[model samples]
Target: MNYMDDFPMLNKDIVYFDNGATTLKPKSVIKAMDDYYLNYSSNAHRGDYKISLKVNDAYEGVREKVKKLINAKSSNEIVFTSGSTDSLNMIVYGYFKNKLNKDDEVLVTKSEHASNILPWYELSNEMGININYIPLTENHTVTLDNVIKSITPKTKVISIAHVTNVIGDVRPIKEIIEYAHKNNILVVIDGAQSVGHIKVDVQDMDIDFLAFSAHKMLGPTGVGVLYGKYDLLNELIPTRYGGGMNISFTSKDEIEYKELPYKLEAGTQNIAGVIGLGAAIDYINNVGINNIEETCDSLKEYIISGLKSIPHIKVYNENVEGSIVTFNVKDVFAQDTAIYLDKYNICVRSGSHCAKKLEDELGIKNTCRISIYFYNTKEDADKLINALKNENILEESLGV
Candidate 1:
């Protein structure tokens, strides 16, 4: 039951709790990438020989793996990109920028990550579109009723995170997507924090588009997936063009593009990383995602219960679900608290966490964030709590 053994980094004298930022890669994922470089190292689609064929199979095979992971209607619907930020930009600039017009509205929440918020802001600025906010409930959860009330005739799209990275509120995305569809609005979900942790089905929810990162899901970094409906992807003009994406070119004036998936992939991709993502998915499937989810939930509950006993720690997301806990120690800077914990070899994220605009919403300048995965144990949480309980030690770092 010790999933920690799968991760080579866990062998060190460290407790990695910064999973929300990025997860520790498992040995299976590492071996998958290593096997590619050690055995068949070649570019995909551009070669016809033996090594090239293996690369092509791996490149295309990962697409199918992502399709099954999110339950997309077709393997063609999944497109590989650099990461979630890259995927969201593709949606905003490739699709929405061309489709939307002046005065059109895109509904989003203020609690969204910078990747989700900045792209929409640029779209609105350039296209003369409007970016609107959907009000959160009293507990900061994105409820369906609030979404219903936020809709207007000018609303063309609704973009939000499946789970907010800072607060860890699991939004009612399925119901929101259904409501948006009824109103003829497109829904773009930022699934960076939700996909690997929870069971996500794009087809069952009828999601128009979903973006997630590989590094957050026990996979290698520098790789991500962008899932879209077939018809909608067709409407998106490929932003990057050159190399393998073009089918034929007669001078600069005439060119024919490849089909879906390939058309979006401009150049040689991160072949090793994509292959590693397939291995990560295989590892998750073997362990069972449901089992992982249940384990993480139990650990989060235990951590929250232990944190409550400490009077100095102010815990946010206490009522929210998921494995992320955001809190601050009384009279201690978030970064300083993190440094104190680091002395004990407990790793956590501290800062605005790339969501700078979240300050006004949460009424705090910064927070210490602890995110757990299946590899974590009760001892890890106990060490963190014991560290916080040592006021004499923590106060020393206050001047830091």
Candidate 2:
């Protein structure tokens, strides 16, 4: 019940509402990292020493945990990358390299984060494939109709975010996946926002690929997961190659690469981060993701309602449903609001939040975003609302 008790950072009396950006790690996750460094901190899968074996086992164990977390068919389907951006780039490059031609198209939605959008944009430019955009509804939600309208015979891939980071709108992923499958188009989901907050089943959803970051889910940074079907993953060429990924090498003419996940994971892997992510997964399991979802959503509803009551404030994506509440006070800059909130030990995010295209489309320069996680309480929401209500921007800025 007392989730905050498990996070050392929460004890500082700071109201942390920036879960969409990254979550504060739990004590168990921190301890997991500490234990790794203290005990078996060795290069994984390289040497025959006992420490190497232990470290390798610990690193591989996180793959199993991730497999279970997303209900993937096998651990081999998961590839470790630097972060969601790395994973997205890998998917875009590896999957589309030989398949796409000059006239081919890659469909992506406007709601996509920059990580998801830019990689494909670059790929399309390099490969001479036309990049097609799926228009968002007036409410900024992507619908099946838009998918249907966007996909043509030349469409080879459809990439979109599972959840829109700006509006907090959950896309109809299953339906989109089904449509893509019917059209023989690969579906790559930017699961960076969705994985930690919602239940994800790669098999059930029939998604070709999904990308997520560990840091957003109470895990360490520099660790990300890319889940693809085993056969598809095998078909994807290695975007990066080096030590620990090759099975054998003979002179300058011959080389044999390792298996699925390892082939994608080049160089020395993030062993400690992966281990900490495993612990974070275990922590989420104990807390029950469903319960976390309900708790955060309840808090979001409460906060958004309170924000709406403020006359001069305009809440972006008020109709969208999720744990993020984006708004701006009248005659106040978004960054100024964030700065003022920081004085009360409140942490919130401002600006375009890495979705430059979405912000441009909406004509919003920036918006203050309050993102909640399972650890946030209704009391925290109350504090945020009360702080906003009590503060006068003119007075605060001028010391009047």
Candidate 3:
């Protein structure tokens, strides 16, 4: 099936491969969000009228969609946030600040995105919790053996990406989560890269907390889901407080909060974005995630083979299962190479990709990344490969 028809932005002249940064929104998603503004646009849970009720129901309904998407136990476990960064911060400040002691250790990896790393770094600085990195394998994927070896008595939590944004290797999170639970260590997964591309069952994996952005999965920006176990979510101190989240303000000091998710989702939310997310989910479901995965896997294999034939291109990842390809052109700066590719109307990501610490692990300062989605075709891959095959194109494009 040609998905290019669904995304109006895709064309023969434009080969977009920067899906790891963000995905192009489908027309259905756009229309869903637009429908809200065109017909009924109101603050949810604040009004009693028909339009208000419609808004409220649509907003709350997305929670159910999200609950089903990740196979969460209940809708009460899904809390809407601005994005994965906001969700991770909420986990740190709301839960960890109160639960962890001064000497407690939280294990993370150098390959994690900044959203997953910085929150723990700040928490460590303020609360005196120790920040530890679980050693990564040579291919940059986390292993069960390393996680077991890294755990100490004080290790209270392990935060990692389900798929490293830079390396695109799917981490062995299910095994790690099972082991962490046995040792009483909470596991938090950053699913920004893995969620829409791969099937994730939070309950099946026994994941303690999972955070992901909707935009990365063909949904609207400024909207994301933070899934937590109901018991654990209730234990967290609500990070934000406002009108919608509280039940009563009897006195200046005495205020009663609502329930599990409302307490976390303070103030007005991205109602239209949430609705668009529901539509995006529908589009994904219709297309079938299994098919998407198979398509991307084949495309990745084809791209890797093509890149291997190019002598100047150095592919960074090995045994990579996902659709992302990170590499650098020999003697050419990553940004310059990306700019040269841009001259051919091929879009790709360059630089550290918000995983700055990964540079030391990969032994490089920056790389050019090609992140493919289902919309991308083998023809698109050929365009990129043929562009790189021209050895003098980089310098020619630079006018050097």
Tens-place lDDT digits, model 2, residues 230-304 = 988898899888987898898767899998888888898888999999999999999998988898888888998
Model 1, 1-400: lDDT tens digits are 4566788888898888999999998888999999999999999987879999999999889888999999998998999998999999999999999999999999999789999999988887787999988987666678899899999999999999998888888888999999899999999999999988999999998999899999999998899998999999988899899888899999888899999988998988889999999998988888788988998999999999999999989998899998899999988889989998888899989999888877777889799999988889898899888888877656666556
Ranking by lDDT: 3, 1, 2
The segments of candidate 1 whose C-alpha lies over 4 angstroms from its true place after superposition are 398-400
**Best candidate per lDDT, number?**
3
**Per-residue lDDT of 350 in model 3:** 92
In candidate 2 the C-alpha lDDT for residue 248 amounts to: 87
TM-score per candidate, chains pooled: 0.98, 0.97, 0.98
Full-model lDDT for every candidate? 0.90, 0.88, 0.92
Better of 1 and 3 by lDDT: 3
Give every collision pair in model 3.
Answer: none
- For model 3, residues 42-159, the per-residue Cα lDDT tens digits are 8899888999999999999999999998999999999999989999999989998999999999999999999999999999989899999998888888889999999999999999
Q: Which ranges in model 3 have alpha carbons more than 4 Å from their true place? A: none
The residue pairs that clash in candidate 2, if any, are none
Model 1 weakest 10-residue run by lDDT? 391-400
True lDDT of residue 291, candidate 2:
89
